[model samples]
Target chain A: MQNLALETVAPVVESVPVPKITAKDVNVHYGEKHAIKDVSVDIPAKGVMSFIGPSGCGKSTFLRCINRMNDTIPICRVTGDLRIDGRDIYEPGLDPVLLRARVGMVFQKPNPFPKSIYENVAYGPRLHGLASNKVEMDELVEWALRRAGLFEEVKDRLKDSGTSLSGGQQQRLCIARAISVRPEVILMDEPCSALDPIATAKIEELIDELRANFTIVIVTHSMQQAARVSQRTAFFHLGKVIEEGVTDQIFMNPRHELTRNYITGRFG
Target chain B: MSVLYFSLLLVMAVLAFALARGRASSGARAAAFHSRPNYHGLLAASLVAIPMLVVFVIGAILTKMIAESQALTALDPALLTDPLRRGAALREIVEVANGRFRGNPSITLQAAGDTWAYVQRVARFSIYGLGLAAGIGGLMFALRSITPDLKARNRFEWLVTVLLMICAGIAVLTTIGIVFSVVFETVRFFQKVPPMDFLTGTQWSPQTAIRADQGGSSGAFGVVPLLTGTLLISGIAMLVAGPIGLFAAIYMAEYATPRFRSTAKPVLEILAGIPTVVLGFFAALTVAPLIRGAGEYFGLSVASESALAAGLVMGMMIIPFVSSLSDDVITAVPQSLRDGSLALGGTKSETIRRVILPAALPGIVSAFMLAISRAVGETMIVVMAAGLAANLTFNPLDAVTTFTVQIKTILVGDQEFDTAKTLAAFALGFVLFFFTLTLNVIALAIIRKYREQYD
Candidate 1:
């Protein structure tokens, strides 16, 4: 795998790939509590960037900040220069409804709409008017499901409720739902946390394949998971980014004391 | 005497509880026990109270029955062959014993009344004795079982669960009792007036012959007029309330801010708290005249007390049922579902209309069915605003009586109990029961199916 990655990809820092997502001094507040402090990083385009930390370390919160999902929380307030494709997403004129359609999200728990599998995938396209007619919509749904690796198992049962699927299949259905809109960037909040080891492998494999077409940022608790699927890894603790670099380097020679302590299983 | 007996029972129960607690831990300090002392006390108290109450109730019933039989002996001997005459004679004798007999009593009647009073007193003493014996027996048995090894807590909990089940069973038993009583009287009514006529007949004047010679109204017992009137008024009410209430519920559930929702929900509920009789008066005194005057201007022949007047008020009363229940079910649609919809970039109104409504369809439907059942059973408004004319018509401008109103009218005025006119009320009640029960069953089935899908 290392031989293949080294042969196919340039050194991330040396090539200076254009940043697909950039955060400068991002902070989040939930009511009276300051949840996320100033955090800054640049995510290279078209690769998986994993955010790893202990629980309550603001990894998921930071991931949600990308698509403005925190805006739904009435008490939550975000102040930062978080940009995607060189555009400030938190600008006053920015439409979260439109931004959400462009930058999709998949949550830790698989939350499919209480609808059929076909309709679940088609919901995004129909909502944003992505498809002009029925044929285009059907083709888009099948393509998304196939890319999510759920088409073979569910093609015969597309009319069945998405909720009736197994846990891993449901998450794939959610992934299919996210991709059906042809989003530019996808934010995943611990997408594989609720799956078994085999399901987790499937999700990891899909993430590697998805890295080719979309800029993906994933928040995971497992160091091994970050090592396996991510190209660049960021370590967050106490609402601040401690270190970020190539996945192999972050796992092999972490620089910060706290990052080393967390990666070495000494203390989180 | 009952008051004193109940007091004695209460005192014994308290004493038994204390004594059992003392007995369970009566040994030296730090003695091991299977259950807590409080459980022993609770078990003992229950034993002392529940059985004694049961015996007391049984003794009271037997005493009354014996006293009645003894009083029967004071009646005239010839009347015994005819049970009906015997009952009437006993009633008069007992009335005489109370010194409220209308006519002057002869020597034999006065002597019989005296004996009847004495027999009642003796029966009362016997009941008191039996009650005391039962109470003491229960106390002794409970005290004997007050040991450290006894599983008092388990027994007490099991007993409480059984008692709770029995209390819940009372509601089921009472419904069955009502159905049986109505069915019995309805059968008697059917014997006099054919069932086919009652069900299919068009006319519904229930003033049947009270006496054979005095030519009174023979009374058409057709149920169609009242049934149609009920359906018509209820339909009007639903047509008025359905869209308005549903929209109000939608706004409250989907669009209202937290501050507004908390304020508006209870205010909507207060509509339900207003008594139906007051609504009836409002319909009669206020809305009816306004409707009639408006009709006069429009050149429509509207009755003064019309179905429109009754139905409008009924619809107002039913609004809260739809709004409050719809709000609950909408609020209960998992937050995850909402987040999923929102993440798809569906606007607020789009998400609500397409997702929330479809998800909440079953619950909303059940809420409407419940409101309709309430409307069908509503009596006071129809009786006051819609005159009790059993006119078979579909026009809302006409005054029509509902089944409930007819039931009320038939039983209220001066009438003989055995007359077909009065018995017709029971038949009406039986039919009304079937309709409301059918509605409730459908609503429940829908709700249950919904829960199965979600849960």
Candidate 2:
């Protein structure tokens, strides 16, 4: 009787349009444990897509796959097709370093280097040779910080330690650092989990404002956070995505029992 | 003998009774309870033991001395007129009284012998009296004071804690006492010899006039030569050890893999465990000859007992001191900093050179300072490899004598203690202590300041 009801309701939910990043039969394994099963999904370009799941369900793993950050872990192994803008990143001769420059990341915990705020934002640009002179580098730093909404608060203390900022400010500093390189895609792994509620709201507003410029993929534990910040939501359980669609329809009317139970607070 | 033994038994019996009474009272609950059963036992034991041990030890020593003195006083007047003869007569009398000597005695021997017998009787009686008093007093005290509420455990713990503190303070006091003794004797030596002569005179011959008619050599006591020799040898040691030890520490902490580090660190530390005497012989026989041969090839004249040989060997002996400490401090730097640098696309070597080395600079400085101090105080290597002549020269190929070498030479064999030559050792010791103490204090202050900046 429940199967009949789910079948009748599934067609009423409209699927969101797929993005330029498409993963076909992607699998990730850490030694004997399969972290991500065979999964296929497409992330839309110039839009915010949030990966929401219970803890240890590989939401962060799927997000890391976009930037190839899992290559840093010695024991992790990834197989199958992964492409960005129809170019296969896993192909031979694709340097992870250059790929990471184009697809930047922000960690869950704010990890600003123990250096001046100017140095922290200028590090990526200096490495990639993005600016021609000192004046150009200064302009780029100010532009990135202003876009991240941290220029007004920290404009006077450009030479102060990056760690001297508060938790919310440090996270925003990390975001400014990512944007300084002008990456095509920004992957955030629970960027606002460590911040207070007010800081979280500000970060969510920044995400909505960022959707017009670049693709943003966020992994969060809060389903409401996904609803507030993302245009599309992908729900994962036990290393598999049960359902994904427009954010409002997934919340008000989910096809899978697990997704409905999770949204309605019946069980997670 | 039976009365003394019975009194001891009575004391033990009273202690057992008190413990049993305390336990029985505790079982009644409410207002009857006062203290734990174990507290009662300890209280009774302390009361019985302290007084008895004190009285027994004191009485035994006093009684023996008094009895022997009285017997000596009763010798005949003629025998006593000659002090040596009277002393011999007293000894013989004691032997005879103790049943070790037997002979027909003259008037002096008879009188001495009669007094000795009386002394023996008095001694026996005194021992019995002391033991009886101690045992009875202990039992009465225990019976009066074994209350249930007494905090015996707390008092016992307090006593133990005080004793531990006293033991720790004794070590510190002993160091201060030694320093004061050396300073006092050195001051006395300086008073007899003019301070200007001791400090400025280049020739160090410390003889004096043996008699009024005979003029002895007026000795020179200048310390410039000794100071020069010490500084030259220590400088050579620092030259040899500093770079090698620091490089080895860097390699072990930053470059070596886990398997290599585990194997190499222990092998390096084993160099420190070898006895200094063995190193002295190796330096004297092997290193000295080798250095001489090398110097001959380069058209330099090197003595068999040159400062180079001793400094090289001493440097080898102190390598573990620098390497182990430097390695520990380098490894103590946080891994987060390393990861942060690597994540910024910096190479591993660049990160270690620019970030890690600067962070560990203060600790490295301290390690080198400690090694330098160890090099300065070293004795066996210099004594064996360097000659005894105090040469005021900086040439490494020449022979030099250090302060420790002079101290050993002056104090060895049969020598007159009152002469300025012997007393100079005390002065040398005082100077060495101050030099090392100042270096250690400066190193500690620098390290503490650096630590504050980071932590």
Candidate 3:
């Protein structure tokens, strides 16, 4: 019965005309540990999707695989077919550096470059050659910050250190940094986990606005956050997806026993 | 006598500690006591030990003065008028007291030696009495004062704080003492020879006559030649060390694999551990002659003891200091910065050059400063390989003498005091000290101002 529930809901999130990310039997291993078992899922293009699970359940691992952030870990290994926009991301011709530029990431803790606020946002545009001139680069930076809802607060002191900002402002700055290069997708690994409630709500609103242009995938610990920010929701348990479907249906009528147990506070 | 007195005091302090700890915990429940048993023990030990040490030091100084006076009495009144003869006579009397007389001693001298020995014994007895009194008095007072609610822990902590302060004060005071002595000697030297000549003039021949007929040797004391020589040698050393050491450090920190780093770091540090004298001999015997031969082959005349040889060896000797310190500073840069750069589509080389190096710049600058300081103060290699000729030329093929070499030459075989030749060494030392001090201050200020807080 659990297998049936998982199969039925796996393809439901990809019902759009063209999917952004497609995975088939993806398995991740960290040394001898089978961190992510053989599993499959599809993320729709230009939508907000959330992966909710207990701590250390491989939700963050699967999220890191989208942008190849897992390459930074020497012991981690990922196998099986994974594609974005109908092209294999792990193909021989694709450099992780170039792939990462197309798919940006925001971490749980805001990690800004130790530079001026203006430079932090301008770094991506300059490196990717998104802007041709200095004036265009400055404009692109301003536009990205405005889209992330940070320009108004930081416009006057653009030369100040990025670390001098408040935690909420810094997270927004990281968001602006990701958007500066005009990426096709954004991978957020518990982006609001270190933030206060107000800051978390602000980021949730920003995620909704970002869905029009870029696909967004979020790994969250909060059930309410998963329900609030995502249209499609997946529940993971023991390194495997238990059930995934429309957010309202997953919460209101969970089919699998483990998913219902986790949502109803019976067991994780 | 002072050592014996201190050892006896140490034994008494230990006994007092045991007694205090045993008594403090005798009747009360362990939980009821305000202070732990260890604090009570420490308080008792320190109370007995500190006063005893103070009295022992004072007694030691007094005993030294008394013995010196006794030895002075042996000098004849006629000889005492002459400072040099008086000094020799006192030395002889001290040898008699120690039972190692160098020559035949007169009756007056042997009698004075007996008197000195007797006085030393009396001084020892008096010191022992005073030490015993301090230990007993302090122990009795400490034991009587201990109660159930006494704040023994706080008192012990304060005592430890004072002890640490005294240790720090000793180091600072010793530095001040050295500076004052050098300044006094430099002043005396300036009074004999004008400061303008020493600072600005070019010649540097200090001639001391062998006899009256070997006269007309007023001895020019111009410091310009020595200063230029020192600078030329140091510049050559820096030219050899700066780029090579920095590149080695960059490779170690940025590109090397973990296994390579683990194996190579210690091997490089071993270079620093080798004594500088071994390098001196190698420079003198091997490198100098090789350069001279190589220069002759090219139709270029190189001195047998060229500045290039010493500078090359000195640079090699200090390479470990530069590489190891720069490696640490570069490796200390946060990995997150690299990640940020790479995620922005920058290549590995670009990330390292733009983000990591910029962030680590201040630390690397300080490493260079420290390396330069090491180069300036180096003694053995310069002393052995570089010629003693004080030449005011920038040519690396010619031999040159550094400030350290000059100082060592003047002070090695001492003939007399209050002479211009010996005092000139102290003046040179003061200039070296000032140069290194200013460099350190500038380095520290750069480190402070550009410090990137990454937490």
lDDT, each prediction: 0.87, 0.79, 0.85
Ranking by DockQ: 1, 3, 2
Off by over 4 Å in 1: A1-16, A132-135, B26-31, B81-85, B92-125, B209-218
Candidate number achieving the greatest DockQ relative to the actual structure = 1
lDDT leader: 1
lDDT for B274 in candidate 2 is 84
For residues B88-120, could you state the per-residue lDDT of candidate 3 as single tens digits? 877777788899997787999998888778888
Q: After superposing candidate 3, which stretches have Cα over 4 Å from the reference? A: A1-17, A264-268, B66-93, B96-115, B208-218, B452-455
TM-score of chain B of 3: 0.92
Q: What docking class should model 3 receive? A: medium
Per-model tally of clashing residue pairs = 0, 4, 0
Q: Which wins on DockQ, candidate 1 or candidate 2?
A: 1
lDDT string for model 2 (A1-268, tens) is 1222432332222333656688777899998899987667778899988888778888899887877777756689999899998899889889767777788788888877656788889877887788999999999999999989999999999988787898999889988988888988988889998999999988888888888998999999888899998988888776777678788878988877878877877655
Chain A TM-score of each candidate structure, as shown:
0.93, 0.93, 0.94
Q: Model 1: which residue pairs collide? A: none
User: lDDT by residue for model 2 over B327-366, one digit each (tens)?
Assistant: 9988987765554444444445655775577668789889
